[model samples]
Target chain A: MSIKKVLTGNHAVSYGAMASRVQVISAYPITPQTQVVELLSELVADGKLDAIFVNVESEHSAMSACISASAAGARAFTATSAQGLALMHEMLHWAAGARLPIVLADINRAMAPPWTIWTDQNDSLSQRDTGWMQIYVESNQEAFDSIILAYKVAEQVFLPCMVVLDAFVLSHTSEPIEIHDQEKIDEYLPPYRPMVTIEPGKPIGYGALAAPDTYMEFRYKMQRAMENAVEIFEKEGKLFGDMFGHSYDLVEPYMMDDAEYVIITVGAVTSTARVAIQELRKKGEKAGLLKFRVLRPFPFEKLRELLSGRKKVAVIDRNISFGHHGIFYQEVKSALYPLSNRPPVFGYIAGLGGRDITVSDVVDIYEDMKKRETLEEIIWKGVKL
Target chain B: MVEIRTHGRGGQGAVVASKILADAAFRVGKYAQSFPQFGVERRGAPVVAFTRIAESEEELPVRSNIYEPDHIVVLDPTLLSIPDTFAGLKEGGWVIVNTPELPENLDIPAKFRVATVDASEIAVKYGLGSKAQPIVNTAILGAFSRVLENVIPLSAILNSIPEEVPVKPDANQKACEEAYNMTRIRK
Candidate 1:
């Protein structure tokens, strides 16, 4: 039997890491994400978790410690928010390039100049090309489940994974979730066994300078590993569901069986959209929602198949690409570009800097999508000009 | 579905009170969700928290902040003067306050039922906090259980205190029980 507890999203992440039996944890304190490491440290100190809790002065050092730990054949984990994530930018690429399957929980906080501790996707979106697999979660339960899944998938594909959730929204929100039996989790996720490790007296250079002759091949191998992750994620997800009864995929489709109008969303916004779609259905509107769970290893074929032949589609992005359109908007349009029957994908930028996206606001977007004759390049919602 | 908005000062356990309510609701086999106002909190500054309870998880899927709450809990009586404290409260809802004054004498609209308790005195008597700034969150929740008895039982609230109230579990439970018995309601 699974243990049930009311946990904040941050604590849920900690429990996820603990359940995975992470061998090493190193982190710096940051808003919204602080409670995550705080709980982990307490667990470690209280002897609940037998792991090395490395106290670091900076996020860069924190990631560095995780990289070193994972390189030495240990399961390593860390959690951080906006600026802290940005500070660890260089080391993020290093971890991925080294093919260490370290799991990092990034609470999505907006990049700040005005100094705000609110939710937004800009911080994580900016790290799109770092070669780390990103999974955005909707609920606190998913936040916990995804971490275990991340380690399972990452360890197999030899790629680092970042489990992302909305700052404050998911991070601070408390909800009921099932904490799976440790023996069951252990049965699913065995101890981490690396093919090679930095052992004493075994002189092997790590991340050595790749000459021009072999640099392209290393990049090619990384790309191949990413391609392999797509299938690995599916297989592990199915296996996990068979064991624990909560299966997940790259994307979650809601009310899309015969939906002519679809809304594409990511992260916590999908929860609100689910409610809005139910309300829309009650009023006899054929509205559906497809939540993008995985950002990296973009589900191109999946998007094309789900969005093909739709009358109209709207992509709601909480993160902007500044000069261009919303980040997910660009990805969706790109995915549908090759489809023979591509729908008009409208881009909407909404709920930046922790602005609440109410059910009414979502319904309004659907109404706006239906009323428009021609598609606008970008539509701004809930923004004061 | 029952939505509750809690108003309190920063130093007060407003967020913890919200969590405790959610935990109590969950103890009775109900789905619960709670969160605080997404802002930097400063001591003595006004803070708000929300708790949502429903029969199923689907009913509480919407993650946005609570706009129109079914009821309101005020931890600090001074916060009652702030218009935003009652901004989106539903009509004919319960207004549970922590004040020494009687519910009938308190300045609240007659449309809503008011329940008042001297939670400060109860908390202080139990030594939950200090004489000047007593941590009245547990006591207020006790009064909440009394006023909204049908929503969540007093036993669940009493049972949830030991796990949630970290500082002084026994004292907090006693304060809650006292406030539950001492609460005065003007309906």
Candidate 2:
């Protein structure tokens, strides 16, 4: 049964970890991401959940703790954001390469130099090549649900999973979420029975340096696992939907049924886009919103499938690839490139550094997309031109 | 849909009040969402939280942060000095405020409806917290129910405050009821 509680995305992540009955949580405190572990700490302290809370000193130590704990036959969880994620880069590769199914909630904060603590997808997008499955969520409820799903999907694929939500935007925003009961969640994500575990009698070398002869095979296997997850995630999402009555799709196409023109975005910004698309529809514009819920396993096929027939698409991203273009914009373009009859994809970078992506901005993006020729790319919406 | 913004300092219950109001509305057969303005997370710093009450389940303006709020609740009267507290509030928005006694020089627009309650005094009377800091969030929520067009029932708020406050449900309930009776409204 589901009981309603208003929670921030951080608190929802905490409840998700608790619902899965996570055995071990090793996390270092970071802005936006700190409260996820903080609430877990209280849960553990209050005796509501039995778990070991490892207060690691750094993000590297945190990931290392999770990796080792998962290897030791425990359901391990951790979270990070922005620079904290950057610091965990080395251990991230290790977690994926060693194939430990550690779950992390990366609250997508903008990276620093100008010392910003705002929402952006840059930090997570930069790690796209890493083997961790990335799941982007739009609401506090989905943030909670995705962590549970991440554990299931990651464990199945023997790959780590990153549940990403916009920092501050979703992380700090409170909304009503149906907190599922423990027994129900237990049925959803049963206790981890590690495929391989470290024991007293069994002597095994783990994460040992592979020779050039074997390294490529291991990399190939990781790619194969990622490919397998694409289908597994879709299947598990359907199963979850059946169980919980909340449908999850890799590419959540909102009001796209009759849309000739669509805006493709992810995370919290998609919520604004939905409102904007509906407003446009009121004025008889064939506008729609296609939001990516599962970013890793790329959902390239799904995007291509949904977008192939559309006349035009505006790809809005909160993170940019510096010299290239918006990260999601680039990904969107790539997904459509192989199709001969693809829409003219317009690239846009907006809401970086936690700037608000308002309904008006979505309307403007749609208006801009209508006026743009194929040559007019990289719209950079909201930047002072 | 009714959009609301709540302003308070760190440690006051502005955020919790907004969330409780949303939940109370939801319990009374409405769709509601409450979220905080993300800024510096230090206590004693100014804080803002938003709530949206929609009659339809699918009509929630989730992605758009409340720009022109239909109502504004000031958990701390001191925040009235900050222009940001009233920023984006339209001319005719409802303003519910917490104060020991109503003060003049509140720079709110003339067209707006104003309501004042001694929520802090009620918090102190109920022994909600230390004398210096009374958790008046629940009390002002009582004021909110009265100031608004009774869209949220006081009974629903009574049932909802305990779920939110957690620490002192009885005190919060009592405070909510007293503030509900005492709120002075000026249209």
Candidate 3:
């Protein structure tokens, strides 16, 4: 029987890990994401969960434990945010290249400048080139479902996956999430069988230093593995949908079919953008939203299809690349550059430094989209005007 | 729709309280969303979490930080002396505080409904120890269950606690029951 439970994004992540039957958990406490480890620690301590909880000294150590655990033929999990993720930058490349298939829940927080501990998308987006698949969540329920899907996809491709949620915005926010039965989850996702296993009986070398002769080949193999993930991602997602009631095609769309204009966003911003569209449509505006739930692997093919017929598009990014356009807009524009039927695209960067973005701000963007607006590179919206 | 906000330190169960409140509300068939506003996620630091309970779909562009909470549960009464604690409570809204000594001399806004309970005392009496977590949330939920009659039933909440706590089940159940009884409706 399904039971309704109010859970934060953090708790949902832990619950997902529990449902995934995670064999090992390695984590160090970090703000915004600390409660995630805290709850998991409580579960492990109380013997409610049978997983091994490895208490590491730092984020780097935490990631290391996960890597080791995964290499030892276990379903490993860990979580971190902000600088903690930054600290694991080198090992992130290690985990992906080694093909350990570890799942990480990254509570997206802003990197230090004025030394702030607030919610932003830069932390996870900055790790885009590390050969890890990234998934953004709009709600706690999505956070719960994303981690389960993440584990399945990661194991299928033997690559690491990161499920990103806004730190304070979604991480600590509570929402009603339906908890699935263990038997059903087990039926939906079977036990992880490693394509590789390292034990004393079969000793194997991992992450051996490569010379110029094999370095490019190793990197190429990693690229091919990521490409493989794209297909497996679809298969696993379809399977998840067949069993569960909710499903999305890597990227989730809201009223985008046969639309004159579209606004693009990621994470929780998509929820607000949908609300804005509803308000605008009431006034007879032909507007819709293309929410990018999966940031990594770019979903370039889907972007091409969604933007091909639209007249105008605006990409809203929570992270600024500093001195250049918003990162997401650059990706969107480049993805559509080859197509002849591409729409006029605009980029808007707003809500940095944990400044909350409101629905009226979204309505304002849709109004501008209706006007078919343009700027040089990226325009900053909602500036106390 | 009724919005509830909980104020406490980082280590406290403010966020958990918000979740339990939302869960209880949902158990009774109300739509709810609970979220926290945190800057420093360090222990003992002040933290704020919010919940929105409605009878219909919850739609908004900008999710506000509970500018006008229908009810405010103060896990730490000392926070009253701190700045910006009770800034935006709606007039006629209820404030439940966890302190033995109510601020009799303190000026309360007219039309405010105020109630006081020694939540820590009840927690200690129930062997919740100095780590005032988990229980405070339950006690507050029990008190709230009584106050907001239609929101949730107290029995539903007791049934939700995991079965692993076999030894202290009676204490927790009693603490919640006592808190439900101890709640004094505002005159």
Candidate 4:
């Protein structure tokens, strides 16, 4: 039997973690992400969940506790947002390179300069080379489901994974999400069996200092794990789908068949794009959407196939690389660079902070894609110039 | 889809009001979504909350904040004097305000369908106030349900009251019922 409840995306993630039977949780509170840790703490205190709630002074210590618990062969979890995530920068690399299967929830909030707490992808996108797998979610259900699936993939690849949700958009919004049966989840995900442990019984030295020769091999091995992770991601996704009657892929195609124009977006924007695409199609225009599911593996091959057929592919990003264009647009262009017959890729940046991006904006994007050809590097749509 | 924008001061249960309305919609088999705009706001500071009710979960997929709302609920009528409170309000939309005065005392637009209720009096009667400030969120919802064309059953709101408001659930239910019965609608 499935349990259905109205929950914010943060609470959905918390429910997912509890259902996954996380053994240890240590996190410092942050805006939008505070509810996640707060609810988890409640569950622990209520005796509804069996987990060790570690009190930490800062995000750095929270991650360190996660690292220690994971290294000791336990399923550890933590959550943070914006500056809090930045504070865990050092531990992020240590967890991934150490090959510990720790799962984290990063509520994607904008970085502070003038000091604003709002939704944006820049925070997580800036950590592109952190060696942790990043999976962005669109809804509360996706946030709940992805965290569980992420743990399975992380454990298999021996790499840490971060399940990301947009700051206030997903993190604070409440939606009806179905909670999976604990027995079914138990059947799907077994207890963690570490391939590595720092126990006296094993009698092995861990994290020894390495010179150039040994350091290169360890780095190469980490790359190899990331490569395998791309495949393991799909495998676990399929496994979860079969059990839950829902499936997720790296690229979700919406009415893309025989479409001449496509709008590419990540996270919740894709849902609005779908509505606009349908509206365009009603007016006798061929328009579709591609929602990027996983950012870590990048899904370059699938991206090539999806973009090859369309005449124009417009990339809408909520993040920028400062001086350059949008981060996802740059990646899309690089992915299609080597293709002999690739469609034209246009970039549009909009809805930074918590600004609203309505269906009309998407309709405007499709109209722009139809009218423009070879032109500017990027169009700053909806931004006051 | 029916979009609602709620206006109130901090510590007035405005955010919790949105959540309860959304939960009530869910109990009645309608897809519901709700959220509050978070910032640094203390007591008596203005805050906004939003709720979306749709026939299907997929119908309410947009995550953007609602601007042109189909309905507006004002937990505090003091927001009426602010010029920006009525921005992006859809023409012919309903406006439910918690005030005891007749329609002449309100600065209500001629185009809006107005509903008025003495939520403060109900809150006072129930003793659900903190010192000088009385929380009228639940009481206003009572008026909202009566004026909302019965989109959701009153029982749903009654059932959600105890779960959402921990203090004085029975008294809050009484206040809500009293407001629902006494609400005056002027189209």
Query: Best candidate per DockQ, number?
Result: 1
Model 2, chain B only, scores a TM-score of: 0.93
Candidate achieving the largest lDDT: 1
Task: Give fnat, all candidates.
Answer: 0.86, 0.61, 0.61, 0.63
lDDT by residue (A92-137, candidate 1, tens digit) is 9999999999999999999988898999999999999999999999
lDDT computed for candidate 3 = 0.80
Docking class of 4: medium
Worst 10 residues of 2 chain A by lDDT: A372-381
The DockQ figures for the candidates are 0.90, 0.60, 0.45, 0.72
lDDT ranking, high to low: 1, 4, 2, 3
Best by TM-score: 1
TM-score of chain A of 4: 0.97
Ranking by TM-score: 1, 4, 2, 3
Residue A123 shift from truth in candidate 2, angstroms: 1.8
Local lDDT at A334 for model 4? 94
Query: Against the unseen true structure, what C-alpha lDDT does each candidate score?
Result: 0.93, 0.87, 0.80, 0.88
Quality class of the docking in candidate 1, CAPRI style: high
> TM-scores of all models?
0.99, 0.95, 0.85, 0.97
Chain A agreement with the truth for model 2, given as TM-score: 0.98
| Model 1: per-residue Cα lDDT over B1-187, one tens digit each | 9999999998778999999999999999999999999679987889999999999987989899999999999999998999999998899999999999999988899888899999999988998777887898999999999978788899999889887887789899999999999999895
Winner on TM-score between 1 and 3 is 1
